[model samples]
Target: MSDSRQFQVALSLLPYVGAKTAKTLVSYCGSAEEVFSAPSSRLLKAPNVGQRIIKSIKENKSQALEEANKQLSIAEREDVKILIYTDKGYPKRLLRHEDSPYILYYKGNADLNAQKTVGIVGTRKATEYGKAMTQKIVRDLTRYNPLIISGLAYGIDIFSHKASLECGLDTVGVMANGLDKIYPPAHKNTAFDMIDQGGLLTEGCFGTMPDPSRFPQRNRVIAGLSDVLIVVEAAKKGGALITANIANYYNCEVFAVPGNLEAMASEGCNKLIRNHQAHIYTSVEDIEYILKWDLDERTTKPIKKSVGQLTMEEQIIMNKLEEDGGTMAIDSLSIKTQIPLGQLASQLLMMEMKGIVKALPGKQFKVVH
Candidate 1:
């Protein structure tokens, strides 16, 4: 790591500093480097900066920087990416939440910012029914080609990851522990496969153990990373419920697969639906409807077609798409082209048949590139 960047890592090591406070310090000092360089009086001027925090900063300076340097070296040697919040590779979704991790240790080939992401979480003691549903859901969702996300725990979490792998989809396992070791130990092989097929992500750095208190915090990371979270199965209270509650707070769609009333595993899911915290997940179609994943949605190289080859409406749609930078939501296209919804749907369908356009998630369309 660069000398200047190590200071950013050092900020996380300060005794009282957390993500929000570190950001505040940076905003006050103008940069991470300045935060360290500014004297105590100057640091005091920053909002929430007081005698205690300034003292912590002053006392911990050398040790924090040294530890940060060691962290950087270990990350480099292990092929792990240490992404501070400001880095381009950091998960943008997490940025919207105040409690998002300030840094992440990622080691994988999968795109952290995949076009679509789905988080599946549930009871650690999964039932056979839960396993079946997870497998089926992943298989059906394969058409949309979304990245599957789970906690890498047993039962539904592991089922979700395994299903994703079997379907040839990338799956990221958010860890409660550090990248240095897999918690639960049994999930190690699957975690290893995910490193090649998907990824393992955590805010915990090297040598950090998976303490019990960190699991709830880890669930927040899973919720933050997902576009939507599915609770395949959960008892009345568990980490899955915690994740669901967090996802709801983020206003991301949450789906709860319905299970029989007699089943203990269904209680939490049923409660979420009953309380309107989540939609009742009946099938993949439920997901398709809310997310607007059109069956024909895709991106492809645009074929050269003459204006003469298109009907007037097709030409109009093409012109609108071009004006909109080659992509537009269905509603946007309708208003832009001044076409009625039914007519526009028909026109887009015809266009898809001719390879002039493709469907995308959320009813968006893009001209074949």
Candidate 2:
């Protein structure tokens, strides 16, 4: 890496030098190298700089360099890529936010500067309603090529990533920890796959473990990277709420899928709607209406079947199969797509009888082209 890159890494490690502070320092000093080369007196003149921060900057310079080089070694071993704020490829939406990070570590194929980005977030312990909403919104959003952004936690986050992958949409999973490790080890496999299909992004440097305090801070990044934030479900309190709040602060459109009021998972979403903090979405059409984004002609085509032609369950299964490839294995597709196997079998039989799908050998099924 060049001197500029090294300076960015150094600045990020400073105790009180957060994204906003770094931006101010860099803006005043002309560049990260210039900031580093500036005297302590001159550095303290920058906004939000405290005496303690100034002392740490002067005293921690050597230690910061050693740690930065170590972080680079770790990043190299993991094949993770780092981007500084000045780098052309750093996410444009995030940079436009009030306090975007100066350095980001990412691993994936997604373009950070994707055309339209939407965030899907919710509680960890999700309801069936939340799962269904997540699947529906993600499948619809994929038709427009919007980059899906979310934390890689359980419930809505994982559901969004899985659905986006199923629909072949690019996604970005933001983390609260260093890129060197995944916080929730259960998501290790999903994180690995995202590197090839989507991406894992973070503002934290190497060797930093996920601390509880970092999550709320991490939520800002999720909100900043997105043009719109959709809360699939949430309890009365959770990280999703934090992201939604940040989205509001950023003046981005915040949306929530309504759920049964009796369910615990719907509490936060209901509150958001009741308090007028978020717009409610019944379908992707509602989101499109609010954001004024044109829907793809392919996705907007009405299902051509008559009401009497297919049962409600069959219609849903057919829609999923169509959004995906029309051909899918009866079992794996049932699991991944969240359709009940018995219902799916019945639906397939009805479709087959109606000439909508043809049954293949070994229990496989393919829709009639």
Candidate 3:
């Protein structure tokens, strides 16, 4: 590991600073190295940087760096990839979140920033219906070739991973514990298979054990990494619901597979849909439609329109769609076009009505051939 990365790892290891606080420190100091070297007065000026955290940074600077070096050595031995926030290999979508981790230990070959990604989460005590739905969704989603993400826990989590692997799709297992250990130990074989096909990702270090509190934090990473989060089955409360809420907060599309209203596993999905927190998911087509994923790329090509015949705004939007591989999130398009949201929405609606473009469920759009 480089000195900068080592420092970042060290900074993340500090007990006084979580992901959010770490982000603030880095933003204020300009770099992780600078955070450690900057004067106490300079550190205090950063938002949420209190006296206690400053003291921790000052007193444990040497110890933290030493520990970081040891962690790096362990990572090297384990063939784990240490990705700092600024690293090219880091997940781009996750990095957008305010509380995204400063250091991620990854072990896998799958692209962390795959063009299409979905997080499938649900109850650990999965029912038969839940298992069937999970498999079916993964199988159908293969057509879009999306990277599958799930917490590598029991029930729905393991089922999603297994189904993805069976469908020849890349899948990532986000763990609550360190990469050195796979929780539920029963899923060890599945985890091993993923390392070659996709990867095992975590913010936890080598010695960190699985704890109840860590799972919610892990769920946020799952929410952040995905473009959409699919709740296969969940109770009225569980980590899946936590992930769904986080995904919504991140402005990522959330989808839930509905079940019999009386079923325990279906309550979360039903509630999310009723509350307008998630879209009702019935088929893979719903996913493809919402994400603007083209079943046939040829069909998504822009309709022929002479530059002279189109409005300047229309032309600009079309260019952006083309640049973004024929699909883009509406928020991204609005920002790229520098068009106000209301005006952009009106324009997109007009385009959709004219069949010049199509709108997907998640405020995503694409040019129609």
In candidate 2, which residue pairs clash? Answer: none
Give the CA lDDT, 0 to 100, for residue 100 in model 1.
87
Ranking by TM-score: 3, 1, 2
Global lDDT of each model?
0.88, 0.82, 0.89
Worst 10 residues of 1 by lDDT: 293-302
**Compared with the true structure, what per-residue lDDT tens digits does model 2 show for residues 1-369?**
666677778888988777888888889889877877888889878888778877877888888877888877778888888888888988877764667888899888999888788999999998787888888898888768999999999889998998888889988899999887896899898888888888999998887789999998889999988878999999999899999999887767899878888989899999999999999878888877765565323343323455467767776667666776776557755876687888777877777666676654224466665
How far residue 201's Cα lies from its native spot in candidate 2, in Å, is: 0.3
Cα lDDT of candidate 1 equals 0.88
Query: Considering summed lDDT, which 10 consecutive residues are worst modelled in model 2?
Result: 295-304
Question: Which whole-number lDDT from 0 to 100 does residue 135 have in model 2?
Answer: 88
Could you tell me every candidate's TM-score relative to the true structure?
0.81, 0.78, 0.87
Model 1: how far residue 297 lies from native, Å: 1.7
Clash pairs, candidate 3, are none
Position 194, candidate 1: lDDT: 95
Error of 1 at 72 (Å): 0.7
Rank by lDDT, highest first.
Answer: 3, 1, 2
TM-score of 2: 0.78
